[model samples]
Target: MRSFINKKVQTIKPSGIRKFFDIASEMEDVISLGVGEPDFDTPWHIRDEGIYALQKGQTFYTSNAGLMELRKAITETLSAKYDLNYSPEKEVLVTVGGSEAIDLALRATLDPGDEVIFTEPSYVSYLPCIQLADGVPVAIPLKEENEFRLTAEELRAAITPKSKVLILSFPNNPTGAIMLKEDLEAIAEIVLEHDLMVITDEIYAELTYYDEAKHFSIAALPGMLERTVYINGFSKAYAMTGWRLGYCCGPEEIMREMIKIHQFAIMAAPTTSQYAGITALRNGDADVEAMRESYNQRRRFLMHELERIGLPCFEPFGAFYVFPNISEFGLSSEEFAMQLIQSQKVAVVPGTAFGESGEGFIRISYAYSIQELKVAFQRLELFVEELRARKQV
Candidate 1:
């Protein structure tokens, strides 16, 4: 019975982030900065809307494409934020989450042996999703000197006749790097030159902290909207992770095929969540800003503390995580993470969870409270001191 399982699924590596977090979960006392979600509870207004929907017996399935009201809200929000527009009827489909949208986009587009190029040190799903869709996954290593941003030159270098799609994950998960308008403009030219379509995961788009330049979408570029599948959700921005709601917008031809697969597979996203999502998109701006400011404060504190403790970390201006170089401590990212958990009772994610390019670094999330962060760093300081002393011995 075990042998009858799909070999492709069996051979895939387990998520490194979850592996250590599971271990820490069993312990008595652990200060974890490993989970990539908002520490805040979902805003009361949004929860009240969901409660209202349930009271009104909205437990039934929405349209296979999702609620028209939610879809309309999706179009309005995208237009307001990124200047990208889509028709609710034919061009937008709400999925389980941004993760589902990624899978849907890949399955709808890729033929077996088609190539999908993505940046390394990205979220965990891109490679596995491409492989599951039977597309070849190509990783373009992002450089720290470039602040971990994907450059146009890298895009041009990775192109081939087989390259069919690019997975653009920005305001990135572990790295917290974002692409500005000029940065996106340069890449748009190369994408046009290569004749590639894109699956842009902008789930973290609203959480950016860069004061000088705001988050920009490549899909908003001239001539690119038709060629891009844009993904976003309420999880990060509205502190709505448990709600499991997300939406995708793209050309009608692509979206039509995606909705077919989604219809049979998921049928529809949660009706209650769809109702909640409509409220989130309409009234959650102030809530998002409050949470973003909180995360930014913790981010600044962690950055300064890591510098004082002699860990050179890349300064991130987006998202809520910091990728710090831990090479000087003479340990692999996994080793440092495990030993820290055992020795100091603190948990952070190993950067290698993202990709091999993330070796010698760890990802510390700033999504926790300031009190928890303060305690976690205190443990981290002790852990580093002990490691340094042992290396000397």
Candidate 2:
């Protein structure tokens, strides 16, 4: 078996996010905040559309690129939301989920040893995906002071002559940080200077807490449309996580390669899911806003409680997570999380699970209900009190 396995694949570690999540699942009465998934169900209308598709016997495979109708709808949604335009026939690709789009983008572009620069404390898949594609992974450590936003200076420091792509995930998982439009301009300038392409994941785009503006995509910037792969999906926004639906848009030349790989590897996305996706794009705004409001409430409540408990954490503006500094407790992030689960049955992910840069922090998700959060907070407060008492001794 050792001889049969690829050595590179053997070097990859399993996802740290799932380790604690699976542990909590086995325990009794534990409130697990380890996973970043949404708690909401797929909206009635969206689910109804899927049911309708099945009833209509639309089980046949769609074209390699996906149903034309679904592809066109995806382009319309991007254009209307972010002023991004794509040719439905050539520039857009429907994937199994945002994860597939990410893998596709990496595989389509990277050659052996081409460096892909991405920020640390990012989605767990980026580094491994780069390695699996035979590309080198270059990680730039993001700073808490910068709200976890990637700075042009940090990006420049990581770039080498072989740097070919940059991966950006805003409304970031684990940290919940987001990059505003002006913040993106600086990095976009650097990418252009280095002639780098970007695979921007906006899966959490609709979950941003900011007012006065919708989420901004770097693909919309001047000269960037041809230089970026914009990835998004219905999982986060429409509560369609299990539907396994997502899409990507990029230049025709790049997308052509992605589609060919997809055609062979996947054939097409789920037909029922694609039909449901069309309805989600056209009529799911109200459902999205309602869920966003709920996540915002939970986020605020957790932030206030973390403050009241005297735990220091950065204020997150997007996603449904809070990354709090627990260094004063004098425990490793994994130790704190494990002891909290043992003593209080409240499970959170160690920040170091994201990257080495996430040391001294822990990521708690607010995707659970308000009542569940309130109970978890009570246990968290008690845990902190006990740690303080031990310190005094």
Candidate 3:
């Protein structure tokens, strides 16, 4: 059986994010903040749409590219939000999730040994997905001092002639870092100079804390619409994770190839989910705003409480997470996370689980309730006090 496994697949490790929580699951009164899932239920209107579709007996398949109306809805949302334009007929693809869209984009665009540059500590899937697609993974270590935004210099330094695509995720997962327009403009210049392509993951777009600008997509930058693949979904914004629907837009030539792979592999996204998605995009603004406001309140509370406990976390303004520096305790990221869970009954992910660059940090999700967070922090503060006393000894 070991011999039957593909060599590339064999090299992959199990997700470090799930490891601590799986143990915590069996324990009583454990507060697990390891998973990044939103606490919100699927917005009532979206759920209603799904139920209505089922009631109408819409259980059949959509086209391989997904429902045309859903694709059109996606395009309209992108245009209204970020000034991006795409032909729903040719450039848009509906996928099972933002995750599936990511896989399809990689498979369609990468050739064997082509290099794909992405930053770490990023979402865990990027490296494994690149390898599964036979693309070389070139990981650039993003700096905490730089707030984890991928700098033009860092990107430029990593590129070689073999580089084919760059994966950018902002309002970033794990770190919650965001790139401003000026930051992206610098990166865009480097990308154009090298003739590189990008797969920008903007699943956290609507959750940004900015009042005036909102989330800015790299694809909206001048001359970038044709060179970038934009991936977004209903999961993060509308709490539609189990609905399992996401969409991608890119150059029609690339999307045509992606559709072929999706056709052979997935056929179509769930017809019911697509119907719900159309409702989500069109009429879910107020629901999203209410959710975003709640998340923002949680985010600020977590930051303040973590600081009160002396954890020294960088302020994260985008996603619902805080990556606090835990190095002074002299424990490795894994050791810190494990011992904390074992001793205090609170579980958070080791930053090193994201990549080597995440050493000396730990990711705590704020998506859980304020009551949960308050209790969890009290335990964490006690754990920190014990560590300090041990250091004195």
Full-model lDDT for every candidate:
0.93, 0.93, 0.93
lDDT of residue 56 for candidate 2: 94
What is residue 64's positional error in candidate 2, in angstroms? 0.8
For model 3, the stretches where C-alpha displacement exceeds 4 angstroms are none
Q: Across residues 1-393, which tens digit of lDDT does each residue of candidate 3 receive?
A: 899988888999999998987999999999999999999999888899999999999999999999999989999988898999999999999999999999999999999999999999999999899999999999999998988888888999999999999999998998999989989999999999999999999999998996656778889999999999999998998989899999999999999999999999989999999999999999999999999999999988988898788888878879888999999999999999999999999999999999999999999998899999999999999999999999999
Candidate 1 residue-wise lDDT, 258-291, digit = tens? 9999999999999999999999999999999999
Across 199-281, the per-residue lDDT of candidate 2 in tens digits comes to: 99999999998775668989889999999999999898898889899999999999999999999999999999999999999
Question: What TM-score would each prediction reach against the true structure?
Answer: 0.99, 0.99, 0.99
Determine the backbone clash count of candidate 2: 0
lDDT of 2: 0.93
Which ten contiguous residues of candidate 3 have the minimum total lDDT?
Answer: 209-218
Q: Point out where model 2 deviates above 4 Å.
A: none
Clashes of each: 0, 0, 0
